[model samples]
Structures are given as structure tokens and as C-alpha cells.
Target: MPFYDYECAECGVFTALRPMAASAEPCDCPDCGTSAPRVILRTPNFALMEPGMRAAHATNERSTVSPKSTQAGHGPGCSCCSAKPSSRTLTRPDGSKAFPTARPWMVSH
Candidate 1:
């Protein structure tokens, strides 16, 4: 089901609803009981790439100095290792540290 955005003219209310494509054009406002105009909203579409396509895309799009590249460059059991302390600390936008306890993908390779 596709979600549609609508705006009520009478009550000046905006909302999103899952409705059929044909019925979305002239949907009524759920709150004010008035006819609302359906608006097209921006939605993200995600597609899964095959392993070969993913590898090719990664090779093309990834920079030479990415974190993964850095991790691979440092030999096994280094600070860049997923099991090390460096990987456990996640930095915030404001330069704060977030201590991650769960080692989801952390393993000494």
C-alpha cells in the first residue's frame, strides 16, 4: 500500500494516509469532515543489489581512504580491528562519545 499526503482546506490540517491511488486524489479530511486535496509526497525507494553489483558499486563509489579501507590496511588485531576499543566508541555530531557495548559485527580476524 502506498501512503498519500493530504491537506485539509477548512481546518488547515495536514496528514498522511494509506489509500488507493485512484481514491487519493480527492480524499476527505479525517478530522474536520471536509474535502482535502491530496498532495504528492517525496518517498524513498530502496532496491537490493546483487553481490557482484554491490561489489562493483562499492569499488566505484568508495573512496580510497574510507574506514573499511583503513581497517583492512592495518594488519590483524590492530586498533582498527572491529574487536578493539577504537571501534566500540561512536562519536556524535557534537564530539561526544557513545560507548557501544554490543559487538554486533566485532570479531578479531
Candidate 2:
């Protein structure tokens, strides 16, 4: 059973659980017992939610519509996206460095 909204003339608005087949029909108000027409004003109430929960809901909704891109080359100077090979020099605390590559004549800066 799903919750449905019904507006009563004397009791304002109230919600009731009913089958999908009877969603279009009016439901009896719990307080007044009067038959009230089904309404569409029962949207999710995010205002009463906690700050963190509300923010998470907002982030989820945004990601579903316009998610952040994960493709390469987000902008200039991106280390992983650069074409040039990165340096692999290992240095010690005394400022001395060693190159592990096969180049024997390479000079240290």
C-alpha cells in the first residue's frame, strides 16, 4: 500500500494508505470521517530534514540530472593528463639523489 493525500473541507489535508487501484477515488478523512478528494500536494517535505541529510539529498538529485564529469583532461597542468613523462628521481635527506634508470651518464642537477 502507498500513501495518498486527501483534502477535507473541515480538516484541511490528511494522508492515507490505499491501493493503487483506488488512488483516484476519495478517501475518508481520519478526523472528520468525511470523504475527501485525492490531491497531489503531498510532495516530500525536505524542510524538516537535518542539514546534512538535506544536503545529501540535494547532491543526489543534482548528480542524477547533471553529474560531475570523470573524463580525462579536466583542465591545463593536470599531472595525470600531461603528455610528458614525469620524473622518478629518489632523493635522500642529505639532498643527495639517485636515478634508478639505465642511463649511466645522466648528470644530477
Candidate 3:
């Protein structure tokens, strides 16, 4: 089941709920019993891999490398052209590096 976040306009309170598909049509605030607006909430997620799992997966994928690399068109020896490097290094305008990887692709604006 998926959890949904809702906020009550009458009482200005937020709550989470797991409702049946039909029940979600007219969800009511638990506090004031008024209709609450459903809001999308971000939830954290993770995948656990045992030792050597990552390496094993990478090894298997490399066996079928194409004759021409997909990134070859970008540039020779370019970071983006290298087998989609394991991770990206970011440098700020001030010439200082931060975080191991580039900013997430889907960050909220």
C-alpha cells in the first residue's frame, strides 16, 4: 500500500494515511473532520547489495560492450565518454569540490 500526505485547510494540520482506492476520493481530516487536500510527499528509498554484488553486476555488463562506445561522439577522453564513469565529481564556480556525485537529476526547482 502507498502512503499519502494530506493537509486540512480548516485546522491547518497535516497527516498521513493509507486509504482504499475508493476511500481516497473524499478523504477527511482526522482532526477537524473537514476535507483535506492530498499532497505528494517524497519518501526515501534504498537498495541493499551484499559484498561483491556491485562488482559482479558490473563485470557481467561489460562483457557485451558495443564495438563503438555510445559516448564516443561527445569527445575523446571526456568524462562523459568513459563508460559512464562510476560516479561524477562536481566542482563549484569557486574552484572547490563538493559531494561525490553531481546534483541529483530530479531535484525540485
Q: Pick by TM-score: which candidate is best?
A: 2
lDDT tens digits, residue span 1-109, model 1: 6566777777764655555755546777778777787765654332455778777666766755464544545765675446744476677899886657756576433
TM of each candidate vs. truth: 0.33, 0.44, 0.35
Candidate 3 structure lDDT:
0.62
Against the reference, the lDDT scores of all candidates come to: 0.64, 0.87, 0.62
Show where candidate 1 strays beyond 4 Å.
45-109
Ranking by lDDT: 2, 1, 3
Each candidate: RMSD: 20.4, 8.6, 23.0
- Per residue, candidate 2 scores C-alpha lDDT tens digits across 13-53 of 99899999999999999998999999999577789899999
Pick out the ten consecutive residues of candidate 3 with the lowest summed lDDT. 42-51
User: Against the hidden true structure, what lDDT does model 1 obtain?
Assistant: 0.64
Q: Is candidate 1 or candidate 2 better by lDDT?
A: 2
